[model samples]
Target: MVQVKLFDCEHEQDLEEEINRFLSDLEHKQVVDIKYNIAALREAEDEQIYCFSAMVMYIK
Candidate 1:
């Protein structure tokens, strides 16, 4: 069977760390693919926000 896990955070490091921690608890060979995405938005003239996300696909 195939399973999907999603991770999201405002900081890239946080997102990376979360994903790493999750994958570490699983067998490496079971991981099939990892897709990463990012989005940027302007909340004001002088401020910007960033969103980092990842999708992990694996065999369970």
Candidate 2:
């Protein structure tokens, strides 16, 4: 089976940490693949927000 989820964070460190935590909770060593894309959202000339879309694939 395969599963995908989206994670959002303001900093890179937070995003990475959350991903790791999620993987750990799954406790599956046979993860097929993990992928993600990050984009910066602009609210103002000097303001930005980070959005991440993460996908996790594993064997059921």
Candidate 3:
């Protein structure tokens, strides 16, 4: 399994788009499974700054 973490995603749509892009890029590979999680956005110390995390898993 390969894990990819995406941070600072703007919204659900962005996350979905990124996932689709990744999957498309790996279309020719022997991927057995794929999963992802988007973490809630939180303040990043700087005012008006927020961030989120997405975790993706790929299995072969």
Candidate 4:
């Protein structure tokens, strides 16, 4: 079986933390693959905010 999870946050650190917590809960499962995507949410003068999404595939 395969499982997937998505996580996004205003800050990259927050997103990473959320992903970590989610993966931790699946420790009993064997992970087959993991993937992620990141994109800018809005345009700014010189900086931009980011959003992230992650997918986890595992065997049950």
- The number of the candidate with the highest TM-score is 1
In candidate 4, position 4 carries an lDDT of: 61
Candidate 4: 10-residue stretch with minimal lDDT: 1-10
Q: How do the predictions measure up, each by TM-score?
A: 0.93, 0.62, 0.45, 0.67
lDDT tens digits by residue: candidate 4, 1-60: 666655667777887888778778776547777788888756767677777777777776
What are the candidates' C-alpha RMSDs? 0.8, 2.4, 4.6, 2.4
The TM-score ranking, best first, is 1, 4, 2, 3
**Root-mean-square deviation of Cα positions for candidate 2 versus the true structure, in angstroms:** 2.4
Candidate 4 yields a Cα-based lDDT of: 0.73
Residue ranges of candidate 1 with Cα displaced over 4 Å = none
Error of 3 at 49 (Å): 8.7
Off by over 4 Å in 4: 44-47
lDDT-sorted candidate list, best first: 1, 4, 2, 3
Model 4 clash count equals: 0
The whole-model lDDT of each prediction reads 0.96, 0.73, 0.56, 0.73
Candidate 3 segments exceeding 4 Å error: 1-8, 28-52
